[model samples]
Target chain A: MSENSTYAEITEAIRAHDSFILLSHIRPDGDAIGSQLALGHALEAMGKTVHYINEDGLPDNLSFMAESQRIQTPPAEPLDVQVCIALDCATKPRLGENALHAASKAKLWINIDHHISNPAYGDLNHIDSTSPATGQILYQLIKSADMPLPDATRDAIYVAVSTDTGSFQYSNTTAATYEMAADLVRRGLDVGTINAQIYDSNPYRKIELLRSLLNTLQLENDGKVAHWELPYSVKEEYNLKPEDSEDQIDLIRGIDGVVAAAFFEELEDGKIRVSLRAKDDTFNACETAQLFGGGGHARAAGIRMAGPISDAREKVLAAISNAIS
Target chain B: MSENSTYAEITEAIRAHDSFILLSHIRPDGDAIGSQLALGHALEAMGKTVHYINEDGLPDNLSFMAESQRIQTPPAEPLDVQVCIALDCATKPRLGENALHAASKAKLWINIDHHISNPAYGDLNHIDSTSPATGQILYQLIKSADMPLPDATRDAIYVAVSTDTGSFQYSNTTAATYEMAADLVRRGLDVGTINAQIYDSNPYRKIELLRSLLNTLQLENDGKVAHWELPYSVKEEYNLKPEDSEDQIDLIRGIDGVVAAAFFEELEDGKIRVSLRAKDDTFNACETAQLFGGGGHARAAGIRMAGPISDAREKVLAAISNAIS
Candidate 1:
């Protein structure tokens, strides 16, 4: 009924339908989990049945969310949801294998995200790149639904926004971000404790992995570009999962004189996952990821290549060098 | 005179003295700068002429302190100071070359610090190991002096206390620490802006270096220890100075299972400066640093070894292996 039929319209679609399913991107980050869980909480608060699914397991760091365990891989039963909402995912294919199928099967599909690269695959798309995180858009949608947010919902939304914006330190943080944070804070969310748990609470093994990474640092092109790689053996020795190395790339990128930093993790499948961070305006890692059929923000980005480690390294270096030159 | 003679006695010594100088230990951290500057500010407020000397140059990151520019290296000026007060230094030898000379020349010598290992080298030593940082002691001393604290003095004191206790997240943070911080906040110090400036303002070059470090990560000793090194050539190419790598050791120490993280930086002199951080209760990097005649706290420590890279690596690894085994 509303003239502005994007987010509000999507909310109505979700309410009008009974059972709902939520999905996010492959190798999901905070925004994906945040948008998924926040919407799920909102739907459940409204007395609607909702199921959240992600093919990849929840990242260890984000496992603290209340409904994290409820997020399943996929339902064995055929997609029975009247409506399905894909949150914080760009392309439909990014939903991995299971959720992608569910998205196709649902009678009404709604897409909600903040990614500029969103493919708009759903029957209804409500994407606002201006929002700092998908959680912000979901907050607006929840408000429009005339439902009061509970404490659990507030916690999830706060984390969703906080993690995506790098704890309000990144450039993406805007006035809206602060307003949303203040709102969440007012809802009995302890920002300081949450920040400590998210950023400060680190297990010992992750520290070891970081030390190993720093040991092999290399710089090129007059220190304008920095690169490092972790072989598969190192992961096995350290008993380190991919998630354990999540924040390592940022450490190297913080060195003085480094314009860009690239980290290579040799996967068991003979593929290399490259995490890139750009420190200066002269380099854009997202564009670099795009060249390899991947994309992310300018400051942080990644690409996955299935090939020999050396070959993938050479290719990535060539692409980055060419871009800088 | 107050019954607590230690603080009053120290304040009077500083006030009565003409041509006074202050010094801190080598590789001074926030506590060192904070204590030095707070004392300097207090002395200036009380109409006493004061000179501060740090033989080593000021760290680039802490240049925001008001007295950072006033910090002087000892020159050929005759040693006319009636007294020298060493703040936050464990031992007289820890004072760098020039400050050491100044300390020896003063008519009266005093040592004020919070290190448990302090040698009590000064003629008048006020060492309180229970105190979180020397800034706390200086706060008491300033209060006892009944000198009005200016905004700059409050800022310097706050920086010292904040950084030393890891922004109130570390184990060293206590009720006393909070009380001091609360008082500083009451004096109109913007805690958020200070924290943002100290922790959030990352240089582009630093991010690039972080990326490089992350790329080369390795996990050793069954994930208990993570080791990484940055060679001088790489640092030179990246235009990164030694100070830029300050937090690399801490980043590695944050891994999920890692107990210890060691970052080895190859100095221009071909010496490797190993910075260590411990995440677990079992491992102590400071003890490891002590094996090489360096010292620090249990969680964080450092050592400088002069040798061929391979030899130094082997020695350091052997020491670490011994510690864990």
Candidate 2:
């Protein structure tokens, strides 16, 4: 029952607690940051002391979703809380093992997530793999407690749901996902404003990266595989940081008739980082990534190997071929 | 009384009719085609003959939603129907003088739309300016008719809704929009498959076009305006046509802090075609385009001007400044 604790039970546990410390996964994504912030806001509204912290702080891409810069990294000492909730994290170590004191100091541990792979490590757990985003799970938890739906919290959750689901363009987007978005809109969510901040704004560096990407676009295996190898020089020449390369695979996967796509970036450490995406999970992206000591979901996966770009490219193509075959 | 016709009344008219000819706008966009197809399918299910026709026929991009290519252009000879439905067309002129034969043959005319500018030319009309799209109005009409919702119809409406609202990225996207999308998903909308077909499948020509656009990216007016020019030679070089540049404005407008964006293309007729997008309606893109003998919505507008690229650029920048000031 505890493993399958309902939102009602999770709400009761939250209400029973006073001071709560919210933790986001390291190098947190919008879902991690948004759900943590939304829950933190909800808890504060319920007259609870909420402290939101993340080890890597926040990335500029997601700073717009944070409130008053409430999320602190290398959090202040003398942390005091009755409940510790891990938001969107699969395991305890995901909360940054080195920063354990902040979470370990709590009296109760609650794990709330939407990942099927998340092990129920907390004393009480509320996890639903059906949810496209953890913010969706937070939407339920906040509702089960019958708290007033604040506009800011609604917007935060909207970011969580939208970013994870590619603004409802991804496969996981469901009837429930759109319904939640409608609810948020009804609650005064500015769909355009939020979307513009999350997606419309792109650094010029992305364009520079795109130029490098398009020049190297290659189709293989009868166009089943569309791929590109980005030399580290592209980043240096474009003045782009590593994170700027995110979502570049989209250009590859979007090719018509393309079933599998790969992006290889030459890292400075003489290692090549490879990202793989499959149109269908049956291709087993995770299994392919595992061959090179990497792991991710079935539709998207990644790995890093110490080698030249050519070797990594040949190896990744082989894994993709094996997976697809 | 006609302009204010309720969904309940509109439903009655559809059931009373035996055959229906659905007319969409010239060069039909997704909203026009989608709403037409959904209503056409609904009428067919109700034991009525449904003729869905467009003067310009379906764009290759939208053929996936055509449902066994039911939508015809320069429709069959001897067209006859009892009811005429104008969908998403702002005016009868949009139906084209050639299409008048099929539509005028009907005894009853029903107009369903969400555009504020619609003339309400139908004997019975259901128009809501507050709704983001015509497919939304169709959703209401179908519900009022109490037709068994089918997957094909739902999918069609979703395509209509998502496309008009730019996949829920535009300001028109409201809570109702998400709710509608959620409902469609529950009814088995394959969001990923549809989105990939509609938005993701970019032709290689688009990349070649982007390369030309990005190479010429320039900023002006204290970075208030970001723009690019596409000389005719680039098209000739890449074997690209005008459609290849459809979403290129995204690359310019997506630049951070760029309030107004422009794309200039050298037209074949010794003129320059300019596309404008304003960050806000206050910028009045339509007003700017109007100066060049063109018009469009407030945020997005286009015009063709008899001038060199430099002159057009200077003149348009001045107009944008005037609008902003």
Candidate 3:
């Protein structure tokens, strides 16, 4: 159990270890699952035994990736692995109980993540907050260490970075991101096919949710703040999953002359889920979220509060108006 | 007019010319205006007098670029210049009559574009249809010729290619497109700021249009073909301009099970403007468009046919269902 590990140290550990298990955050995203597969595939290419496990297994949307089936639920018993690697997880507990129990047998622990909030709980940590996605960090690590990059690793890396960066639309995207994508394309990654799968494939429920949300959309504070609400009834009517409404707030946030956008949704548990997005640094979404004991980044943040959707919307809109003013 | 010209030949023309006028097609988009600005700024940096003129002028969305102010409407009198370079236009007349008149005084005509249908209607033509955008072509020509890349040219090139490639998500996006973007970022492009301006800024009217379109959305052929109609009445009610409804068809096109999507808009002159987008090569949008005497590429095409909107939708949807089947 040492301190922070360099790319060389990480690579050396990979070379030295015989068996490994990889885990990412629960309710896995492209970065979470993609990071594990990318580094896992690279290790497998080097003739190392690697197991990929996630608390929630893989989401239905990510089933398009041919090798995503490698990510499975943790077995009933802990596996006989010498080293355990945690990727794209901000904290140890976020990996879920079953995943941790499955990795308990590993003698050594390695943590690789890009979240600034990560506590470096692993025995050996490689935390790079400046990197937009853990996938980007793995790409740098693999390239720096000259790891064997299989086609699985190549496409996985692109999806991981591309999704985390909002298909390279987010402000966090860097020159290295584009450079990495360019290299991946040169390595035979089909940008069109992958991008279509990632962006164009939307469930019909999502559109129904969008139509419902738009019906509830409103402008306030002289059109500088735009907000919308979704009652639990609409969710029931559409039989919508939580992921169905993901990023739907962008519809209002994208409106010109609006500096801030807010989405208020009523949860079945009698709580309101609030998502806030700011267009610029002038208004801090995290700060506004913090006012309600929630947290996130400058431009995007989330909150959960007691609701009757109307009351929740009023309180949040007031805070947003105050912040932007 | 001479036949096809090489990169070297186009460079030689630029070097030889003292005064130049740049023009693109009417209803200029980011690629059209961006290509003009990118090459115009480069030539201006090389001590050449450059006049930036377009028939329809810059769209409001693209005005965020600082150098975009240079893209002006064609003046009544023809410009006195040694050369006129038409960028991103497929046909000569697409540049509009006013733009052609403005360029009438130029002795040499140089056409640089990425559209495959472009006729070689210039004294020198550099048409690389394989390139995704005219901006990518300009970036390559500038870098290959070792021309000075001013900040304006660098930013302009990024926007040109980004918008044309749907932020590099389209099938036409190439490895070189990503490479060019990487180069622009390295040369001090603030990708976050520019991208926000390009993507996040949408007028409220656009959202209104989306709401109206969504209400009319329908899925036919067992959800394989999705179609939506926009009646002329809704346009009048929303006080909408044509640009407000641009790309709205993508909402339906992106549905998970949809193989092809169509948008039927009732125009003021008893015409229905139909835009068809296919998800894969199996559904040839151009072929279907040609059935109604319209044409475009394999994946995306358009047709303007006589309509009551119902008849147009029925005809187009059937064609799409047949194509997909």
Candidate 4:
């Protein structure tokens, strides 16, 4: 086992177990999928039976990862592996029910993540809040373990780090992020190709949906907050899939003088899905999301509520107003 | 002098001079401003009197750089400097007449740039086409001279590198780009704050103009081309200055299924300003811009036209159709 790994115990467990299963959060993002696939490839190289599983499956945007096909959406049969490792999920609930049950069959549960708010819920937890992405932490572990960082591992980690750090544009990016990115490029990651596919390859339908959403843009509290509502009907009208609305909140947040931005999606079951993005803790997205039984980082957070979008809009705006005022 | 610098003679000239004038291209961008300011400060540290000159002066957004106050817009006095350096301007015409006459008055004329198309219209030229931004090359020069790089220099270089590289998201970004950015961040550049002000601080008027522009979006040749025409009237109608329409073309270029995008703006003189953006040289933006006597990089390019908005739009679309066909 590598000495640099804070979780040498986790590596020892991996060595002891001949088989393993990897799981990530529901509605898997780049960090979740990248970490899962990177770790899975490393373990598989050791002749271990590695199953990379996600409950909600891969999002449409991250389809470019080299090992994307390896990500399974919870196979029909129950898992029976010796060791289970959860990557990027902050809590058991984040894994959703079925993936949790499948992973529970394993004797050892290892959790690895980089979220500041992680609860460290696993038989062995190695959470480095300082890391901008879980794949970053995994990179160090792979380097320390003397594991071969084949192109697949490097590509997956590149996706994880770039998306998590907004292509190294976010505040979380450090000297280490750039330092690591340089190493990944040397290890056969085509930075340009990966960036183009992950970011620039938007389907036309998404822009069509965006056209209508931008029309719905409204400002509140003296333009300190910007938001738009997307009813379930808009999705049906535009033939939009779930991922079509991804990052639409940025359009609102990118507007000048907007301290906070929110995206409201009306679910079919008379429920509303709200994602909040704030410039900083002054707006407190996490606290606002917590009021609705959802949570996330201070800059970005979300919640689900049983109400009409109009009602949710009224409520969330009030919360944001209170947070900032 | 740094062994890495090809223009050691340029540095020698700098060390030999007591008074200098630095000129950048018209409608100066962050690179023009940043390189000029960084080098100007370095020259001033050597107790040289330096005048940073630009025809149109600094963009409103980069007011954060410490030396912005020193940027002069076509100062009344003629140049009396011992040495003159052109920063980031590719050709004499790029200096827009006034600065060229000013720069020509110096005893020695030097050109420092990263453009491949530079004509080397100076007594000494230092052109590194492989370097993504002129600032990247200048950093080595500053380091070689053993000049003190204060926060101002670091921030200015960051602006130059980041804006030219599209915040390090462009294809030109390499291991060295990140390496240099890391060094800058360590040298007191607040990457997050600087990035937010330079990028995230768009005035609401721009989005207002974008709203109307998106409404005008139309697809041609099976959506291979996406375009919108902004009759210069919109600027006056929206109470917008010229710079407000900057980066507006990206909104059209960012749309999916568009191989090439164009923004047709009617100039005050009835001629149109045509800017073309394409994914690759196969759609050749420079070639398209050149069709109307405009020139720029392969990916992004611009030109001014002598025709009605409708005629230029039709002609450009036909040319784009021909180029891709």
Q: Give the per-residue lDDT of model 3 (tens digit) for B252-316.
A: 88899898999999999979999999988768898999899887677788899999999998888
Q: Which lDDT tens digits does candidate 1 get at residues B14-126?
A: 76776778899888888898788888877788777788888785777788787688887777654667788888988777888777776566888888888888877777788
Residue-wise C-alpha lDDT for candidate 2, range A91-174, written one tens digit per residue: 678788644676668888889988776788787888788888999989977876797567668988988888888778988888
Candidate 1 chain B: worst-modelled 10 consecutive residues by lDDT: B1-10
Per-residue lDDT of candidate 2, residues B103-122 (tens digit): 77788888888878888999
TM per model?
A: 0.62, 0.90, 0.93, 0.91
lDDT of each: 0.76, 0.81, 0.90, 0.82
Displacement of residue A146 (Cα, Å) in model 2 is 3.3
Report lDDT (Cα) of residue A148, candidate 1.
Answer: 57
Candidate structures ordered by lDDT, highest first: 3, 4, 2, 1
Which docking band does candidate 4 fall into? medium
lDDT of 3 at B100: 97
Off by over 4 Å in 3: A1-3, A269-325, B1-3
Deviation in angstroms for A14 in model 4? 2.1
State which candidate, 2 or 3, has the greater TM-score.
3
Candidate with better DockQ, 2 vs 3: 3
lDDT of 4 by residue, B1-325 (tens): 1122355677787888799999988988889999998888878877889988888877788887886988977756577888888889888898877776766668887888988888787778888888889888889788876776877788888889989987777778778888888888777677667776677776778777777777778889997899987877787888888878777777667777687999988888888888899965569999888888899988999989887988888889999999999
Tell me the spans in candidate 4 whose CA falls farther than 4 Å from its real position.
A1-5, B1-8, B231-233, B260-325
